[model samples]
Target: MAQPRKMLLVDDNDESRYQLQTLLEFAGEKVVTRTCEKTITNIEDNLFALVINANSLGDYSLETITEKYPHTPIILVDSNKNHPLIQQQHDWRVIGSLALPLKYPDMMALIRKCESFKPEDLPSQTINSGNTEVLFKKLVGKTPEITKVRENILQLTDSDVNVLITGESGSGKEMVAKNIHYLSKRSNNKFVAVNCGAIPSELLESELFGHEKGAFTGAMTKRLGRFEVAQGGTLFLDEIGDMPLPMQVKLLRVLEDRTYERVGSNTPIKADVRVIAATHCNLRKAILEGRFREDLYYRLNVFPIEIPPLRARKEDIPLIVQNLLQTLEARHKKKIRLSSTALKALNDYDWPGNIRELSNLLERLTVEFSNQLIDAAEISQKLKQQGRITPSRIPEARLPEGDFDLKELLSNLEANYIKLALEESDGTVSRAAQRLGLGRTTLVEKMRKYQIDRDDISETDS
Candidate 1:
């Protein structure tokens, strides 16, 4: 068996340190306890898996630990989840922060997560020659609409002008923002995203500009906002049309001055970040109705990118499906192929929900038809169940015109049925065999023949 990973627990409070150390030992982890007064020189950073820093040590700030062990991951522990120190510290080395007294399960889970961390998992600044092509492929189409989107992204790379992306909901506006960020010089820094529609108006200011301790009710600690966190990087404001008029005025000021103050503090901070805003709603209509500010709209519309709805580019369905299936296969470790007729059935439909809806449907199909060739009949049945397609709109599944291998077709049918049985039986081999009316050993042999293993069945359990 492998050795237990060593973790460093630093806290000045003896009682709290003892409790955590005991818990870690009980959970089969090697714990090294240290008081805040200890010298940094005494500790070997590379020997420990992670550092659990609880409470602020006088002159020994979290930044001190981070600078000393630049490569090590640190988990901050505080009495308040929204502690000022937590917000102030934005170093990438800090994986997360937790409130104390700690819960056993949350602590253990975080420890396990840290143990799995690899240095290479951090985002790299390196971009290969095919970086543009690879980023465009994420948009997943060669149609004129998508090609123009790619070209627009390419144009925006050389400049730091604000971007306004208008698209239908689920049409990949955020993906476009991310592509622009990754392609720009700001790729190495944080790419902070905020959904303006989701945050309430009362809290939106603090969410964007952060707030000082006791700025408002229940504001026990100072917190850093999206703008501060996204310094020297890109800030993506999604669903900008939904922003309240009052907040829009404040945002417009920040845009014009390129500076903003915290919710309570009068100190002005320079906003060196690039802004990218996206909205599905028609901002011009909103402006006319006086629901959205016309001035803010003009300020954000410096460079606009309008994404074509999925229905407008039905010809790209086949390529999108192939891409989605490849992703699903990588995640589930089971390949799923669609027949020509199935592709036609998808192409025929109007995707009101765009790529997001298509991705959901593909995931559902993967669960129902793992390691199987999906036909038009199955696609139509699923779509009908989803209330997306009417009976009249269902396409007919036609057989191949040329001669086919009957044996291979029969084998595929058998494997699909066996896999379905295993799924319905909750991945129990014995239960699956009984459902298929076969001996357990015979069913196992067929699973081997079809290359279906315990790994595939276990994925279904998840």
Candidate 2:
């Protein structure tokens, strides 16, 4: 017989608490539910695990709990992104935050993580993976679109080609870049990523190319640049379109000559780094407008991989939810599951912010309504209250008040989003398609399928 698992779930939502009980029971674990108003003094020592909803525990002091139960591992389920206590702390070894819309896999992962550690070693950084780490976990789904992207990644991984990944701001571009580098021969080497748009132009040169001794006024000592440090590895240039014209010229030289002169140094240093540049901007248009360089664009566009947006890959939502939930549960130390209605609401909505937005919503759900099975009503209510969740903005179908065909509405929404995005982008099919996370060619095909006009759109090769 298996030992019964004891769990303590603290949250205010009645629905979440009950649903969480059912899920944990089904998982063959005994669960003990409580409200944040109840003190930790009530909890027995050596319980299976303790999961706290950070939102409800706002009034309750954390320092008190840490002092009282220093032996027990505590996981914090956080719904809100800006938690006062969470932001104030620097290193919280015991406290891991999970954003909501509860997920079962995430819960199990968290439990497993807790079980792997001893109470005496409670506040430690290293998490023991054991056999769990080797478990073949799929990060996302295998939609036809995603399958093709995966195939392309596999093909690109073995080669040392400089790749250009173009997509919308939050369309999982970095994840794709990391996959490519990890799968490639340069997996052993460092994968250094630099956000070209975020850094000031004045500071970007030194960041990419090492600064020499007395390189500038504040040049205290010689420091190796990102490129030199990432030697025999991959360098990810995010938001490349924002690079200044002067920086673009230097970047172009680096790409072509594979050598760069450090600041305050005449001698050129060899940089054997594979470049993977990403941008949300239309580089070709930027080049035409003289905002970006044409030569640099071609140099980085050797192997272009464009990630589809959340709207285009609706099929992947379920898988993404699962993956994200598992990640959250492990971090938050709570077990939460989603209801059919909740899943439908997710499917119906056109996620403008993409995967990042979905993850945020889930995190919120886990903290605000943990310990319950979350349905559509709860999801809508919570999202509405937060101002982050909006009703499905798809234009094609008139969704009546009563029960409707979710799958049909979703398909219509996807097609309509693509068609409208294309139209709004001045028929610049690529931009419109990119807005929908579709390839230029895919957008043209989708336009034809939806009986929309493709003639007015401009398709400049990237």
Candidate 3:
């Protein structure tokens, strides 16, 4: 039979330790109790799943335990939510944090999470050598830049470290995170994703750590927090740069100690969760400007991964388009194909919104155009009507007598047209090409010929 999971509980308080011991034993776990000053050497060689205690566990900080046993999860309990020692240690996988005294249900639930914990319970996928090759194929293109990203993913396979993904809004940051999770040892765990920007600050804490019945005026029932739900899994903090300062502090504490209290409860709970955070914003700048926490930045930056924008890797546009088209067609139950002219148009425009815009456009096209092969003219007409790109109005300045410089005017017009095409298509070259009377390849050539820098405008606005 498989051996029962063992848990080490370190606390100076007799009542708290005894209470926890009873609870753990009731849950069918083998509990080992030790005072803060007690030697932890016995745990060093055993397969203890978790270590639970306050920040001052006898004489050591949770970081000491984390350093000694990197793979074994540790949950820290602290009454002071804003403790600095706890904040600095927040980078690791902390499942929960609780205050003094304890609530039974929440604590028991946390223990259940730990007992049920398995690497496969997380939401990450598995990417083997063959899967990596498949992903490369699906991702498209063979640019040295893209090759480097793939290489980084490969390198991360052996380590279970926190990762911070940065990229433009639609540049597939989450996809990269999923690929990393699947490629790593945590592939079997659940992958719980959270949009830090989407949840209101007031709700963020509850959303992340959950709330007990009547925790707040509006909270009528018990709810499991993302951290608890994502136990033995990956918690993806999307748009992490947008998290509020207060929330950051709370989050920092959780990372430092591996424990958290629910919205209304004071009982300390422990969780065995992994975290993966992503954002398009420049966190360094945020830290300098007092927008993001410096300590938190360091914590999340342990494994930084930057996803290049679509324009930077234009070679992948065709492949991305192919993949997007297939996906859309499957979803919509259509067999639409892009004409050579349409395909060429798609290849030429600059994609500013990245993959997301491309995917959205494909969905729209499949829905509106159906099975008929889409042509450049029809595509261009549709884009113009949508106001994605507008033609440049004739400039009254330097009008020669009754006429204007046709060559100069045409150049201006072309520039305006490409700009309009870019905007109409949400900065996607392929979509812009389809919207313009050009092929994707032709659009690329024209962009090069026109000496246009798509990023200039993108940077100015974004």
Candidate 4:
């Protein structure tokens, strides 16, 4: 018969240790209890699936245990629920932390999670960093830059180290984050994504940390925040650079302590989710202007991965388009082929909108033209129109070479269109909103996003 999984429990509290040992044994686990830190040496050669440490065990060499037993997961038991040091378990290489007075449900659940980790399931973090063809193929590219990114993603699957992914908007930063999470040890759990920039600053905290019922006006029901919802999983913070300054402080604290409370409650909950942050904004610039916290920047910059813009890696365009074409074909139930000349035209144009724009254009073509073969003439027409290279009023407009941030592009386009519509309407907001097909409130918000001065457009028109 296969031997039962073994767990090493360390605690000086006799009753506490006995309780945990009995629970593990009942669940078919080989539980080894060490009453003194000195006795840890006795099991130096033993192989354990997990190590549970209670604060009563006193100071022991965490590095020694982590290094010697690299595959074994270490979980901490917090006797004092509010103890500050418990927050730094991740930094100390502990994979998880449990509240004091262990409940069998919570303890067993965590141990069972750890027991599922097989050494062969993940390659060593330091070995074969680039050999992940399975995950690498998900991204369409063979360039060295993309290969390096694949290597980084492969390395991240084994541990819950914080990652900061930087790239222009729509450059697949979040997609890469998802690939890492889905292929990771925590794959069975959740993957929650939050757009830090979209939510208003006033409500961002409650959205992230959740709140108790009646915590505030209209908070009629208890809610689970993204952190809690993502527990034992991964949390992806998209557009992280736009997060308000105040929230940065709170985020850094939770990152440090691996814990947070509901908006209206003081009870600490373990923030066990792996964090992956992405941004198109230049954070260093934000830091210099005192907008982003320097300390928080460093904390989140543990392992940095910067994705190259689409223009920088144009060679990958063919493969990307091919994959996208297959999807379009299946969805439309039609055979669609791009003429060689049409493919060349696509390769020639600089894709400021990146992969997202490419996918959108293909979908639009499939819907509009159906199964008709796309040729160079149609490709050129649409490419120039969307690239903003040749509008009816403007004969030839050259976009700045290889420089277009998705947010900035959208904002600028909206602002310019609103200006044109206002000019055409003789500077009337109602008429302009009508022409732009936007509600007045949404138009106003877009105007504010672009910071367009009302007087400027009207003055030019007059």
Question: Among these predicted structures, which one has the highest lDDT?
Answer: 1
TM-score of each candidate structure, all chains considered together: 0.58, 0.56, 0.57, 0.60
Q: Please give, for residues 308-382, the per-residue lDDT of candidate 2 as tens digits.
A: 888999988988887777666766776578988889999988876677667768887887767779999987876
The pairs that clash in candidate 1 are: none
Single out the weakest 10-residue window by summed lDDT for candidate 4: 120-129
The TM-score ranking, best first, is 4, 1, 3, 2
Off by over 4 Å in 1: 1-134, 388-462
Best model number under TM-score: 4
The lDDT for every candidate, in the order shown, is: 0.76, 0.70, 0.69, 0.72
Better of 1 and 4 by TM-score: 4
lDDT string for model 1 (227-289, tens) is 999999999998787787899999999999999999999999999999999988789998889
Residue pair clashes in candidate 4:
none
RMSD of each: 17.5, 18.2, 18.0, 15.4
